[model samples]
Target: MSLMEISCIFPVTDIKKTACFYVSKLGYKAVEYLECKEAHICLYRDKTEIILLQAQTKNIFPNRELYGYGYDAYLYTDDQEKLEKEFLEKGVKIVKPLNVTDYKNKEFVIEDIDGRWIAFGLKIKD
Candidate 1:
């Protein structure tokens, strides 16, 4: 079996803020907003898609724990320089700055408002 697309679901504390961040800061477009009491914002960039689900449950877990014990998502891009510049200019928190690695690519890491890790990279051409 072959995979068609991958969608990461992130539990957000504030739906509106998270939605805005994805749209304005990350440059992702909202494909559809599910009509439900609990807000579900569906966003996509090219083929990659993500769903931001506002947690209706009254669990008092920390933001990191609520989203998942570890990283809830990662976004890979071919335009590393442009992506990095845009994110930095927008004042998005950069967990790791852009750097070229021996592994054969230039990459950087940034965290969304909700603390989700987004790694942008460009493959090195020989």
Candidate 2:
């Protein structure tokens, strides 16, 4: 068996607010399932999907906060420049601009409403 797709799950203090950020800033469609046993919001954009779960605590601890250096999520994309430009035009906070990493990945990072750093890039093949 082979894996088909993967979705990022984030625990957010306010599901509606977090979902709004993704929907407005990131241009993702949000579907609320607050009536479900596990209340959550599903964000969709292209082939990407992020599930926002209602957090028990008000504060969110992103990976970089606990690990010192790490991204909450790394999404692979074909057109880095275009995506970066689109995000910038949308008023999204780009914590890191488009740049080639030491590992040879053309990537850029954005700071989400929950302070999560998400990197979007594609590996460069020489």
Candidate 3:
């Protein structure tokens, strides 16, 4: 099968807050918005996209865990310092500070409102 794109569906407690956090703070663009049976919003950054679904049930997908113990996604950026500063200025909660690592890149961690950890990194070029 040919790979195309990756999309993650997240259960949000409040759609507006989630959208605002992503669009206003995280710098993602809203690609789509729908209000049908349930409110749905799609936020995108470059090729990466995430769909936020507002379900009727209080516990959406109760059987399954949304995010694992660690980070759910890793976002690569060319300027880690700038991104970190922007996020800090916006008052976004930083789970971890930006630091250089021997293994891969300069990276940091942040958590979404829903408690999903996103690892932001800048690739170390030789």
Clashes of each: 0, 0, 0
> Tens-digit lDDT track for model 1 on 1-126?
997778888777787788889899888998546577755889887878889887776442543566554444556678888888988898889987999877886888888876677677767888
- Number of the top-ranking candidate, with TM-score as the measure: 2
Q: Give the CA lDDT, 0 to 100, for residue 94 in model 1.
A: 91
lDDT of 2 by residue, 1-126 (tens): 999999999999999999999998988999989999999999999999999999999799999889898999999999999999999999999999999999999999999999999999999999
Model 1: CA > 4 A from native: 37-39, 57-70, 101-105, 122-126
Give the worst 10-residue stretch by lDDT in candidate 2: 58-67
Between candidates 1 and 3, the lDDT winner: 3
Q: What TM-score does each of the candidates earn?
A: 0.76, 0.98, 0.77
Error of 3 at 92 (Å): 0.7
Task: Give model 1's TM-score versus the native structure.
Answer: 0.76
- Candidate 2 regions exceeding 4 Å error are none
Candidate 3, after superposition: displacement of residue 27 in Å?
1.8
lDDT tens readout by residue for model 3, 77-101? 7888898899999888998899987
Cand. 2 Cα-lDDT = 0.95
RMSD of 2: 0.7
TM-score between model 3 and native: 0.77
- Model 3 residue 93 lDDT score: 91
